[model samples]
Target: MSNGQGMATEGEVQEGLTVEEIAFIHGHLHDNVGELILKAGKFKGLDVKKLAAQIQSRQKALKKLPEWSTNEKLIFPPALSVEQCSSEATAHYKASIVSGDRLIDITGGMGIDCYYMSRSFTDTHYFEQQPEVASTAAYNFTQLGATRIHVHAGESLHALHDGLNADWLYADPARRDANKEKVVRLADCTPDVAGNAALLLNAAPHILIKTSPLLDIDLASKELQKLKEVHVIGYEQECKELLFVLDREMPEQDFKIKVRMIDAAGQPIHELDFDREEERSAVVSYAKPLGYLYEPHAAVLKAGAFKTLCTRFNVQKLAMHSQLYTSEEYVNDFPGRSFRIVAVCKPDIREISQHIPGDKANITARNFPAKPEELRKKWKLKDGGDHYLFATTLADQSKVVIVCVKPI
Candidate 1:
């Protein structure tokens, strides 16, 4: 809720408060958090300001991660700290990737990733620049009954200069600048994971770097060397994080990009991997909208998988650039939503009105001249119901509106 990094005095865990007092603070943090400082002036023996900060952090984290939110003993930093932490789902995905003897998190914020990542490894080192955050992480780890994580409060680079080696060295750089503005480029992120690639590679055989979901995958591969694989992770069909895993001994040319979706309807996981050459050389058929419409998952789209998607699904691309796909038969296991074509007509109100048989319909545009808002106004249609309209361009260079309906 609150954006500012409010009081972080929770770093002094159990120092001034007794067990009963800490228990009281945790009990009211759920509902009475806002009123505690206002009415009581002090929540038991805990600082009211600190209690408020913890409540705000916990409330925000609850939506993103219910596991951490329900933990009564978990110590959270200010709003900014919890805001930047990874969701439990994404962190669990990252932890599933590597399993070894040791792990070192170069940039630990709320330590959500490390908290899960440490489970796979026998030993883990969490390094954070902020003392309060680091102390909070240490306290939280203990509360979670962790026994292997070694919390280090300082710069991770300085700690790694001693030639420490591990199975994995991970870094999720701070994407914000001094002005609190977002830094889109990898080089701009604090700790400069791309700039100090050589040093990081030397610290571990495998290095995992998490970047913003908007980061260009191709550009990042060029910026960093010894690439092993790039993971595009999504949750509930929405792309969230871009993970790059670099192997010290691996060659750059022999790398693959794996696009993973956490939820694919009833299926638990959906994954597709392709190399640069394969994607470049892939030949996908193109055709007009025939029997059904297929849309790739969000993670697949983010992986620059326009061409390769059609090849994998054995479908035809609507156009060279347009990501819409079509096939003569139904694809039972298609990764995305499937819609059967009801009617394909030109962008004429007379034809659309006659066939609609409904008051409102959902609209989608692919490779069209006008945006959704402009087209909605021009089409004179309401926005609701199960009906769907697709305004797109065909391969023959014709702009048409295709009426698509969900399969019952």
Candidate 2:
């Protein structure tokens, strides 16, 4: 199954490639190669090495598919364009459908957000600083079937200061400096959030700003007034991004925070909300630590609703130091999964070795002095297990041990 140039031809690639092979190619392909392969056909097996070899052989030819031509207007490769559009579109779609008319995208990166929102609104305005990015966006939008979008190729604040009116203002500032240093906070960007607030406030009745997940939520909430909702999106329990929605017309009520998890099927698996008062630790014991330990999601942690969660689950916090809660019988319908306590030992390696002499052990250290991986190495533990051991501090501020194993 090979093409004339030592690569697989369209027919051969489709016939020979596995799902995993296609995924690898999808991940590594350049815009041109990706466009060629996708148009050739979808691959459906697991021969990644063979697919890589094919791609390597055809690298030169693939480069000739089409450069990002502003005039010719070829199809934007799904690999390059779709990845960006998926994230951008999700944000734009969410904002557009949330009861709004006019939309102002302040930091229009590639214009994918603007492209999608254009369909849902009567007018859509996009602002971008880089000339190349702006041009690329213009071209990309045309390729994506968007013709009516207005691109403001300049500084976002400048465009905003020029008196743009919109029902919803969207901004995704450049979080990287010229030297490629990552900007972790609003203050680190070129036009800091504070500096651009006035312009944003005047531009629209509501503003939706996308910030790095690394930014401290507490600091961001405090700095951005009129912030009504904080959303943390996670995939398969791994946190991805944070969204802050600010509304100028509405007075500040109790802060509402939502944590959402989307599964591979594109369905929301979980959506939990916390009100202002629920974000506090409580003083009651819901239930005693049984055989399992459960750690809630990051949004739960951020909401600080340990008491509420404990009360709802009928569980008790393992200890003051441990953020995880424990219950005796298995709560099959728990929001977060549950794990059974398999083994428990002190932080001392000698003691740990005595309890579990195997070469592999799963180690988790929370509220303990040592890091998890470091302790794993110190105890000469390899990784393989349904077994989980936690080194933490008890409610009385005493060092304690926790061992977890899921019930069958």
Candidate 3:
């Protein structure tokens, strides 16, 4: 249950990386990491462990942080930090909204967000409790050509508790409790955001907190006072982070939640802003599978925008409980996958066998009794093909299987 303190051990890293180590890492940048690991015994001068970390992390950065990944001199943390830290896409999204004279990021793990967020501010503070992580961020910030960030090593809340007002206060607190357990609630996290929001507001009027995507938005809004907006961010259709913005002067009546869907390049594909009333009164019409099936993107689904999806796209809900949608006319700009109805039938073993001619076909389920694996076993369908099967509940609460072709 440990949340894992993903930092490098003492002696594993130095104050400054050596020239030879940097050269060794860059020389093997394009080489296969697995083959290099197999031949590590042959390299007598290079520290294979550090080289492996550089290679592994660089491979991830190439895709995760394309702009920063090319810098050969940047110091990368252990695998845990590399995997857990915010991707360049999410960091850029944070940068787009924040603008001010000064800003501070308290839980600066790999400093990815700090580096990007500094773009919108004149001065920035990067704080981390771990000295090694702080030091690494300091060095990489310079190597990556960042000019504004001031790296501060220590507990962030204590460092800024002196009542210095900044334009923006940002934090992505460690989502683990003292017992090393993974914490889902904001109060259970280190720095206890729920308890310290008042204390933090004393330093800045506006605060942005990043939390787990699994956190319930409705519950968070109730627990966090002065909460202004909840942003559900997604990259390549996969939901990544839940960003909460709180303002000191904004009243609850003026509060609004915004959901943004972004692609891999941090471009917004779709966005919606709604009040609590809109969510409560939003009505969705349900019908059976029509000419086409529209599946909302992951971010919209996480934001619980079922009614909004139907209203925006001019689609009908397949069932009240089912999140799937359908429309008679093709909606070209639908956020998620769109499928043309090839056929529809009850999910009988013999019917499904007849619907899908091939043994291999992609399968999915929505508001259905059985899992994908179970359906595959029952129908003896393999896992690929031009065809796709969706097992969903109709508006009448009847179990039905949908056979669909590629997007219209």
lDDT of 1 by residue, 1-408 (tens): 111111222334433334665676567767765577686654455566776776787878877878888887677777777776788888888888988999999997888899898989998988887777777777777777776888877788986787767899999988656676644578878889888988898889999999888888887788888988999888885888889999988854477998888742212377788988888999988899999998777888888888887778888988887788899989766666789989898988678877686667788888999887787798888887776888999888999888888876
Residue-pair clash count for candidate 2: 12
Report the C-alpha lDDT of model 2 over 372-391, residue by residue, as the tens digit.
88878776788876566778
Question: What's model 1's overall lDDT?
Answer: 0.79
Q: 281-386 in candidate 3: lDDT tens per residue?
A: 8778888888998778788788888787777788999988788899999998877788998889888867766767769878899999999999998888889997
Candidate that scores best on lDDT: 3
lDDT scores of the candidates, listed in order: 0.79, 0.61, 0.80
lDDT of 3: 0.80
TM-score of each: 0.86, 0.70, 0.90
Better of 1 and 2 by TM-score: 1
Off by over 4 Å in 2: 1-99, 112-122, 176-185, 264-267, 284-288, 332-337, 347-358
| Model 2 score (lDDT) | 0.61
lDDT of 3 at 3: 12
Evaluate candidate 2 by giving its C-alpha RMSD to the native, one decimal. Answer: 10.5
Question: Can you list the residue pairs that collide in candidate 3?
Answer: none
Tell how far residue 94 is off in model 3, in angstroms.
0.7
Candidates sorted on lDDT, descending: 3, 1, 2
